[model samples]
Target: MNTPLNLAALVLALSAALTSAPALAHGEAHAGAQAQEVVKEQKPWGIAGDADQVDRTIEVSMTDQMRFIPDRIEVKLGETIRFVHRNQGRVLHEFVLGTKQDLDEHAAMMVKFPGMEHDEPYMAHVGPGKREEIVWTFNRAGEFDFACLIAGHYQAGMVGKISVSPTN
Candidate 1:
């Protein structure tokens, strides 16, 4: 029944969560710090959105199989979206929004620095049985990507797509 594979996956998940323990311990302050660090750079995806400005909310779920339900999503340019992520599996997961290149670069970084802590308006890290939300405005018209860059998760194909329709 692939017990060894299952055990390996569990170990990876626990390790991922443990690595973020220090940042999580400080609550939102550390999260805020991470978000600020990311914000200092130009966002290749979209800008952070105000909660009151969200045009709609999308519900997404993550599983231990390394997948996001409804992996493809569409939105209009200039529209703000609130992503509601639920971690239904017995592992840690994160929702990070970016362009394909942005995601790829970040994935590579995750492999090098698994315990690296940083956040942005477009990222939400969730532990098992928990939920998190991120609001973002799709100011540009292009295809973006979302992924879980937790150690082996991204390599296991835990990713999603976002399409922003062009506006005149």
Candidate 2:
């Protein structure tokens, strides 16, 4: 029973258990852990803004039609925006902000793991007839994307754009 083959099997089992511990502790599974961890770092789109320093507040409404009312938003670079999200639909929705590439990757992950839960400063999850808000400082000047990455939502055209213009 103490053969080399048995020892190798035991080592592999232990290695998998050890590696999965952290992911379970964080309530994230596999690739989901990587996605949430990436959100904690600074993104090229911008960083989380302080609520007290909010330059303006924009109200966004989500509906069952798989759309965000006023899907286009423009802001000046370095402006802090408090985005108030209202879910007017009969189902759940989420607003996630990131670069187009990041959004695309995250959306794909969402398709694979529909139950994955991630709470970042750039994301607001709202249930039916619920309200949520996220404050973000657009310090970069470029075109970014915001979307509802709940399984099929993103693919249903539930996406928005944010244009950050360089400050004069």
Each model's C-alpha lDDT?
A: 0.82, 0.84
Cα deviation of 79, candidate 1, in Å: 0.6
Which stretch of 10 consecutive residues in model 2 shows the poorest summed lDDT? 25-34
The lDDT, on a scale of 0 to 1, for candidate 1 is 0.82
What range of 10 consecutive residues in model 1 has the weakest lDDT sum? 22-31
lDDT of 1 by residue, 62-118 (tens): 999999998999999999898899989998888888878888988898888887756
TM-score of each: 0.77, 0.76
Which is the leading candidate under lDDT? 2
- Candidate 1, pairs of clashing residues: none
Model 2 steric clash pairs: none
